[model samples]
Target: MKLLVFAHRLELGGTQINAIDLAAFLRDRRGVDVTVHATEGPALELLRARGLPFIPAPDVRLHPSPARIRALRDTVCRVRPDIIQAWDWWQGLEAYCGVHLPEGVPLVITDMMMHLTRAMPRGVPTTFGFEGLRRQAEAAGWSRTALLPPPVDTEANAPGASDGAALRRRLNVGGDAVLLVSVSRLSEYMKSESIKRTIEVVRELGDTLPLTYLIVGDGAAMPRIRETAGRANAALGREAISLAGAMTDPRPAYAAADIVLGMGGSSLRGLAFGKPVVVTGEAGFARLFSPETAEGFIETGMFGHGAGGADNAALSGPIRALARSPDLRTALGAFGREFVVANHGIEVVGDTLLRVCRAAVGYRPGRVALTADAARTAYFYLRERRFRVASRDAVERG
Candidate 1:
């Protein structure tokens, strides 16, 4: 089947990465003709390396841009794909608007976020990242929804996939130091607070144990994260918290790490690298992956939500234990690699997507329903833009 995969952006983010990986798998392994469409970023290199057919998407200055719609429409006319798979809800909406009513190609959405939005069309076949969110979509009366967990490329991310010695030497990490790495976007929404708390935990423990926290990635929260890292380093009287900025492929860092601390796709990649992962999430959620905790992560995705607030103590416990025992870390790391290869391997996820697409083909939404979905999404976009402006004005006024 010919497929057009719409990546939200070709950046070093989870959802887009998953989209690209799946596209490659489908084309090379499953023999599906696939093309990727996206606005280019650092991940452009990765895409080119994968050798997939590429279509440059129009740059976005705003949500639901007319130019973007026109661009997608033109591409759809040229490619005439059997199915258009969009990586997230916004891209899904864009694809929905771009396809002509008479074309009748199905638009399938894959949303990786923990929450759902009312703006997505109920008629489209949607796949969520976790089982809990899929059940929530069903409960909300969405017509068709499935669970497609974010996939990890086990071969590319496996232990010894890259040379860790070079990275360790460049970072000046000592042999005895416990190298803790977190590869994330550094976004403020769900990551900044947890990142800062992790930095604090590293600082508190640095006095007694050899510890180094390596943060990998850059975003809006960079300033805040840098500030926190500065304070932590000052308290430790050394550079215990290191920032490696960002990389298109973080395999070297992952390979070099003694323990990984992160959420979502980053956590999964850590496991793929045979590194023990301390899954960190919003509101002070941190847990070591083991047989007991495996089921919970599988059900809810590789993230956790806590009610109270950020607690540094909660994060420190697991890191401290891992730092103390080499045997425990080695055993857990082996378990983690086995678990990821069994459950979240890219080939497994690619087959599931193929099944979803085969089921979704030849299905089309009514004109009235399509129009309503667009209207609802437009209204939500406008409201969101206004709120952003108002918040910016308030900050400026202050």
Candidate 2:
């Protein structure tokens, strides 16, 4: 089947990267024809570089523009895809607004990476937030929302498969030092404050055990992070921190670390590599793996200390203990790796997504009869004309 994927950008973040990976996987494994459309940004260049089929979607904007929406609708009509899958909230809105599909064509929406419910509650601006998209989805009358977790490249991220010691040596890390790596953009919504606090706590723990903290991405808060690192280094009496600006390929950094201080997506990647990950954010959704439902192997702590913050005291003992014990790290990492391989591996996620897409395309909601109670509830609402009244009110308000 032909699939047209929509994403706001093709940048190296978890969502964009996963969309690309999914496209690649679907093409290679299922022989599905795939075309990626980016509304804006530099990710288009990366998509072209990867030899993926791409179109510049000019009307796809963060905000509404009727003219642009018309242009997008025309483009969708020309492509005539069997499935149009929106990667995130912005792309989802654009897909809902832009696509004028034939009767058989299906529209699928996915919240694959960051959860808006979690991010917005932590003070991220509504303009760039998922809450905005959630409102759009509700307003658009889209009933189905699928949760597509990011797919890790298991072949690359698997531990012991790569030479960890050699990677560490290449980074000039000493054999005696315990390395803690975090790979993410330094942004407030991403919990940069937690990272800074963690650094300070680690420094306070002191030089009794040599430690190295490597941050592997740059963003709006880089300067502040650097300034804080400088102060932290001086207080600790050693240059224990290195802020390596963003690298396209983070495999080397992931391979080198003894422990990973991940902030969500990076944490998931670390867990895929069988590393023990400590995550702090909105407790319900920011986790790498769902401890409650995940196959009983992966161990991750969901900190509820504050929204978008880590539990410093709870985390400190674990960090020190893991740094001191390689055996414990190995055990925990092994369990994590098992859980990731079984669930979040690309093939597994891809297959699940494929099934969802198929179901969506073939869906006939009317044909599936509801039980008596559900039918009665539907009848009550219909008789009261609640939906018609609400929709009229919404249109009038608009």
Candidate number achieving the greatest TM-score relative to the actual structure: 1
Model 2 agreement with the true structure over 1-398: per-residue lDDT tens digits: 88888765455565666777888889888888888876555455556666788877663222334544565566577787887776543444445445522243466766633323221111111111123334553444334544344577788677765676876776688988888888776665544665786677668675677788888877677889999899989988877888888767777787888888654356667877888766544322223233442432122222223442344565576677888888878877777777668766889879877887777666544423313323443354446443321110010000
What TM-score, computed on C-alpha atoms, does each candidate reach?
Answer: 0.92, 0.76
* Model 1: per-residue Cα lDDT over 1-398, one tens digit each: 99999876676777768888999999999999998888888888888999999999977655556677788888888898899998766677678766734456688888876777666666789998888988988898678898898899999999989998789999899899899999988777777777888899998899999999999998889999999999999989999999989888899999999999988889999999999999977788888998889999988888886764655777899999999999999999999999999888998888999999988886767778867766766686666552221110010000
Sliding window of 10 residues with minimal summed lDDT for model 2: 389-398
Candidate 1 — worst ten consecutive residues by lDDT sum? 389-398
Reference-based TM-score, model 1: 0.92
How many angstroms is residue 191 displaced in model 1 relative to the true structure, after the best TM-score fit? 1.8
lDDT of 1: 0.83
Cα shift from native, residue 359, model 1 (Å): 1.6
